[model samples]
Target: MAIEGPFWRAIAVFRVASLVYATVLMAQYRGYEQPMLGWLVIGVMALWTAGATFAYSVRALRRWPLPAIDLLTALACLLASPYVQGAGQGAAGTLPVPATWVAAPVLAWAVYGGRRAGTAAGIVVAAGDLWLRIREPDVPIMINGAVLLVMAGVVVGHVARLAKQAEARMQRAFEMEAAQRERERLARDIHDGVLQVLALVQRRGRRLGGEAAELGRLAGEQEAALRELVSGTAPQPEGATDLRTLLTRHGSPDVTISTPATPLVLPTETARSLAAAVGAALDNVRAHCGPGARAWVLAESGDGTVTVSVRDDGPGIPDGRLEEAAGDGRMGVARSIRGRVAELGGEVSIVSVHGQGTEIEITLPA
Candidate 1:
């Protein structure tokens, strides 16, 4: 059951207990301006107690009208106490006819509308109790009941508000757990079924040489895309993008991407700039080598820095090739990859050894 169930039940129990206490007090003290009229008021209190308990127990009935009526009822009973016990009785330290029974509405308001509502209800009842002092002449004012009423309203209301917040947090936690479980189950199913078929097609296409090989390559790309989708990378918040999500999009049969298992959250513009730089490197591999040449993209984040490395299995760039290209106005390497990284307060390092392929590593402050 929800946390609120126990609160309502407790309120119901308190109402019943307070009602019994009031009945005993009224019976014990027979002195009154009108004894029969006082019992009539007690009868009204009994009926209202039963009605309030019923109303509060129903979820739909715990609204403005009910709580409003509840406070008004309690105030009526409290004010009636003066007439029932006579003005001098309360001034002489005798308990009111309703006694502590009037605090029920305060607790109800606290539970219904939190601390402020509870406190307001307490003040209303306390004011009515204090007003009784006006009826008594030349007697020391008793404010203990008023003080206790206000305190109960404030404390109980605060507790009820905290309980509501705790309940909300618990609900969100349960929803996230259930979603994770479902995602894991789906990932397992895809790994066992579709992933195996895609892997087989990729292997067979690689063994065969022509159009079938191309078809197999496409299948491999689809397989890679599927793997990333089920990798349990949740969507990032607005204005923020996970670098892995953008980097993984570049994954293919010929191109592989490796990123941290956890999210690499960055500003949307930063992640996009990084991913675009990586894409340029891959474009270089396809332009320099054949389409069949493979590449790997590695993304790492640590020590307040983010690094991405794009390495391609292609004939390495000849010595001074980038400088030569920049001199010739062929700025693919200088402009596309290097310039983008440099603008973002980062440095790019290109390593190429004749037969060992080329690697471009970009590092940025996180």
Candidate 2:
């Protein structure tokens, strides 16, 4: 069975205990004759006692705010029961009725609201009853009930504070687990799908004739864009891949791009991807063309198409070698750049002589 919280459990204990206390006090006094008004009052008090307990039973199943309601009910019962005892009329034999239990409301409020408010609640309740002077004119009521109520309030308030802290920690742990799952999902998508396709295009585009060239170009562009996105530094969309802009960033300080005076507006996704592809090729130049190799970026815009060429003063690739490498499933040229261009309905071609140097001439339908 699910456990009831201290608040509701405490209320149940109080209800049964208070009911016993009230019944005992009533049984001890018999001299007061039953008056019609006294019976009516007793009936009402009985209703409150039973009603408060019923409320406690439901609280374990739902948050019923039982404390606030129970406090009012208990007060009403105490108020009605004292009149039924007929002690306010100064009945001497009945040991004088004292409605001091009215202050029990402070205990109810404290456990519900917590320690920070419990002290103030106890003060207000004690003061309210003192202000009213709940004793019959000549009677001295027991102070023990008030002291017990105050203690209950303090203990329950402290317990509630600890419960609230435990709930907060549990919520934070669930959130951390959810966040880690999302990160794993992102890493998997990048590794298996996007990166693999780009690698294939970049390698194949290097050697194969015709559309194989185009496939290689598209792959290269996607790989660059993906890398940037993963790093949280994807390029801002201005237009399609700006070959000149990308080349300038990766190109040597001496390397320059020749372009139209008006900047072309390319699709930003296309532009960044393409630029990244060219940048990858430039990286190749720097790595393979020797430290002394110089490079340039050239671009042209027309007919909804764009072309970017990265040329280097470096030793050129041998003709049969690139195809041989692809046959073995090596992906450097096939997937790195050409695949992306092919996806974009364009082609990539590389021209080179073993001694004359190399040029990566890539054309994409704008």
Candidate 3:
């Protein structure tokens, strides 16, 4: 939790107020049996208050020991009330030695440890005050003070916890905003510099022919990959896309794609993710199976769900092949296909039979 500076300043102010109140009560009553002892205790409290204010003001010193010591000191004063004011003196309406000074430790606990600690501190102080007034008859004042102390502890602790949470959320929002801005700037730089050069190289190399044409094809593939990368990183507008349209674009002479003629609209992000997963499956088919291998993509939408299956009529994956690939840290199936679908609240399944074919199916909620 981020402790604010103003909270410590408020604590310092409370300590000073408590000290002033204690001093005034001691002077007003003048009921201590040992006047010298009472004065000595007042002087000690004054000095301690000043030292505590300085210690808490320094951020590094504001930790467990400080608050523990503060609580102990306040409790000690409360316990010593009988000695300072004399037995039966409080019964005659005389104030305890620390009086309002007890609030300092209660507030410190609330700021440091929130509601639970605050309540504990309040109970401890109230118990000590009650012990001092145990012999006094008609001690309603002390009981009322105890109630108020507990209430203050609870309220202050709750507020402090809320403030800390609010600060954390604000910090996270600022960090995310900065990261988005940086991603946009990098996307612009790639589009203007690397992407343009790659496109020009591909165009010029294709016109040159022969080995140059093959290089041009590779360059064209790289340019397409770069475009996809930039598009994925760039911020997207809120909208929906027709899933059929997106999938239909992936069909080629070597690959067959089938989808409903009617539009299947989905959130832009969900459609993009599903399309990317299907693309990964197709890429696997092209890389592992021959480029000439025929593949079919089938899409179905019904009952608030959409299913897309990519099947290829090529030599199927041998048993344990995927596990062996995974052991070698090849995560194409794990990350590219399964990871994408899982993130979109979807699932991916693969079925393969040796010498028959392989099929990858993805199911997603609409």
Candidate 4:
């Protein structure tokens, strides 16, 4: 159901309850200028209350014009209070004929247009009440009552807005879950059919000799790329995860992590990809550097960009070694690290020399 349904129903109940309260008050304060006319006005309030309840229950009727008419009707009822209760009685602090019933339209405006609209509606009704004070020299304005009316508008409107935002987030989460399920189904289909065929071709071609070995190499590369595609690493439209958390997991006696006091939040996909790139760099460290080698990861964020640096105190890359590795189809640096960063609109810089340590700096748009 729509979030506004309960609010409208609550307003309906308030109107009915307030109507009953006003009727009992009218019976106690019976000295009106025209008692018969006052009862006729009460009848009108009953009809209008029923009509408004029906109107507000329909989503199509809860627009600006309906609320505007509702507010105007409320003011009319408030203005008629002096005639119905006698101006002298009102001056003695007698409650208006509609009593708390006047607040119903303020709530309607709140549910329709949010805090500002509700406040405006409250002001209009308060003005009508204040007009009575001006017309009768002895009539005292209830400042607290006016303030309460305005406060009700502001508070209810704020609550309504929050409800809408929560509903939208819930809807998006459901959509993302459905999309994830569909992706998993498609991945299963492809893995069973096309992926298996590619793997078979890669195996058989490599066994067939010179030209076939080259074909097998190409097939193996395609299979790897396709597998990555089916890995369910799509970017999400909502939520953020801290990059510091992902990096901290790599910390140990040999690996050190330095991060800001505050969180280094990024889109979930961006953070994961960057963390994976750092993982790839660490993998290279474990393969080339000895098991006892040490590494440090530093994460920093500022000025619309986030940078993560992975440094290792180990024998560094030799000149032209990365290029040779790429030529030999060993793409640890060329594909895993660089490809991931590039996809996130980021840049990767590697500084390394034969005997010195190596540092990989990745900078991404925040």
Candidate 5:
């Protein structure tokens, strides 16, 4: 059964109201006794009972448990009330001991919630009645009440633990929702602000002359990096891609970025991811093989797939070395290239021979 917090709140309210009723009855009965003394003691007990009720109402606001106060109040009544009983049972009738009425709310606070709160209150009640134990050594009534109160406290403590666990779970749920929204927002900004600027620069580069054309070329590389990020195709950024453009400018002054001679259609998303992957692969050629490293960019389309290969005449990756490089957080080859390719239902295989060179193969479903 789903236990709504309001249900516990209603139970707390009822327990308090019952205590208030018991208080009023005790006060009315004591009005016929030594008016002043009787009224004063009743008022003190009533105040304590009211205090316990107020604690439950705002218990959640407190960082620590507060229902302990209710238990303390009960113990006070058990001890004090017995002492205030009839001084002479000879000619006069027995004076009423209103301890149980005070004890009732304390018990409820302990039991309703769980054992800890209940046991604490029960100890006070039992200890408070210790005077009776001294007077009648044969009767162990005080110890009996104490044992019962302890049992109640144990139950209340367990219940409070459950309530606290529920509160923690509720707080964590709110935090996760807030975090997910933040990730979505960051993705949008990279697409609109960074990616858009890079795209503009790439478009203007082909027409510009001299250094202006070089500036546009750098922008084109950034566009590819941003494109991968916006799509979440690559978890890592292609940082060394800037070097790829420097190599291209030096190696071939009239760099012709050729598209297929025949019209080949690809998913807009697939093309964007492929561009980012190719951009990272080119970066590896420049950084490791050096700017003088001769490289070829080839794209072939057929069989509902497209493959882009970057082959470089630089020292190739050692056998089983690509995994070691990726493990170090240099995700240029892993996150930026393989990650993007994998997202597009693609395959990547790197063939490198010592002293020969390296060839990176990437094939993606169109």
Candidate 6:
């Protein structure tokens, strides 16, 4: 759309130049038998050129009527060529009334209606010019002029169309980026306040027992569901988000997270999901290994892949414990940790010893 400004300005400049060229040609030829008529037509062309230049500068005025009037006026000038120059003057090398000034209308049509309108305007103006010069010996020159007019129209129209399409795509991308930012902001707000409160209620209710415990369990379930919703793995917008920036938020005194000083960039959704999976692993440590248990999260990148390890210095899982939990319909590790990583074309491996500790490693293509 910004290109329209420069295009119209160029059209204005072209009109002024063509007007001067037509004036010089007419003065040199001195072929007008009707002097007053010749001067009157020139006056009309000059006034119209000024008016069109001003009208096109204002976007609202650049519509059908302006270009239509412009084409008709140019055609009228071409038709009046013989009368103004006298019967045999056109054959004696007299110029058409508007001369090169006719290109103004052709360009206007091209800008407004693209290739089709441009070609149509060119054909109509060229037809009128040729009709007036039908008996001239230099008929080939008129034919060549017509061809040039058509080509100019097509080229200008094509450029205008491409500019419009590019502008549209830019607008859509801007809007989508704005929406993505808003979604992330809302997700952050929910994660910071609502999810934390729900998780606390669930944990406390189980300790209190009775109906309070039941309420806490319900809240905990809702919290897990909400966390999933907030950290949804929807396809990201083009480009990468810094994974280190996202994971840094999880650092605490009891749980230490170590990452490379350099930025770790991945698709926006992938980074969010990976961070959520890490959070889920930390949640498991706090729930099963006591809140005071120490945990370390380490991130490493190499060989076109990234690996994150979450290890806890707490009693390790007993053999078949995970299977027993799954049989009882508890899917904390199954869905929250492994499921999230697997969706990103990654693999999750669990290593645990009866007394020493437990470690979970997630490896994904970079």
Q: Could you tell me every candidate's TM-score relative to the true structure?
A: 0.68, 0.43, 0.67, 0.63, 0.44, 0.56
Model 6 off-target regions past 4 Å? 135-141, 198-366
Question: Candidate 2, residues 252-334: lDDT per residue as tens digits?
Answer: 33355666655655677766777777877787776687644677888887777777888888888887877897899976678
lDDT of 5 by residue, 1-366 (tens): 133345346545655565566456555554243445445666776675566556545546322345455555555554554445433211133223443454464445554555655565666666655555566444433355556656655665577667666877776667656655665777776777876776677667647755666676577655654443344321122232222222232223222233355434454455556776776777777678854466777766788776767777888888878778778777788889878877777899989989888988888775
What lDDT does each candidate get? Answer: 0.85, 0.61, 0.82, 0.84, 0.58, 0.82
Q: Which 10-residue window of candidate 3 scores lowest in summed lDDT? A: 229-238
TM-score of 3: 0.67
* Residue range 1-366, candidate 6, lDDT tens digits: 666888889999999999988888777766578767877888888999999999999999888999999999888877777778885455545567778998889999998888889888888887777676675655444577888888889888888878888888888878767777877888988878998898789778878877786577568656655664566433334678777766666665466779897767798889899999999998898789974578899998999998999999999999999999999999999999889999999999999998877999999899
Model 4, 1-366: lDDT tens per residue?
Answer: 399999999999999999999888778775777778678777878999999999999988877899999998999888887777664455454788888999999999998889999898888888887787677766565677788889989999999999988999898879878877887888988999888888887788768856775576567656765765566543434588777767765654456779897778898888999999998998888679865577898999999999999999999999899999999999999899999999999999999977777999999999
Candidate 5: what lDDT?
0.58
Least well predicted 10-residue stretch by lDDT in candidate 1? 84-93
Candidate 6 global Cα RMSD = 8.8
Task: At residue 154, give the lDDT of candidate 2.
Answer: 80
Full candidate order by lDDT, most accurate first:
1, 4, 6, 3, 2, 5
What TM-score number comes out for model 2? 0.43
Q: After superposition, how far is residue 43 of candidate 1 from its true place, in Å?
A: 2.5
- Summed backbone clashes in each candidate are 0, 48, 0, 0, 13, 0
The Cα RMSD in angstroms, rounded to one decimal, for candidate 2 relative to the true structure is 16.9
Scored against the true structure, residue 54 in model 6 reaches a CA lDDT of 97
Please give the RMSD of candidate 5 to the true structure: 13.1
Show where candidate 4 strays beyond 4 Å.
Answer: 89-93, 201-230, 238-364
Candidate 6 local accuracy as lDDT?
A: 0.82
Give the per-residue lDDT of model 3 (tens digit) for 5-78: 78878988988888898888888876578767777788878887998899888879989999999999888877
Candidate 4: C-alpha RMSD after superposition: 8.6
Give the clash total for candidate 4.
Answer: 0
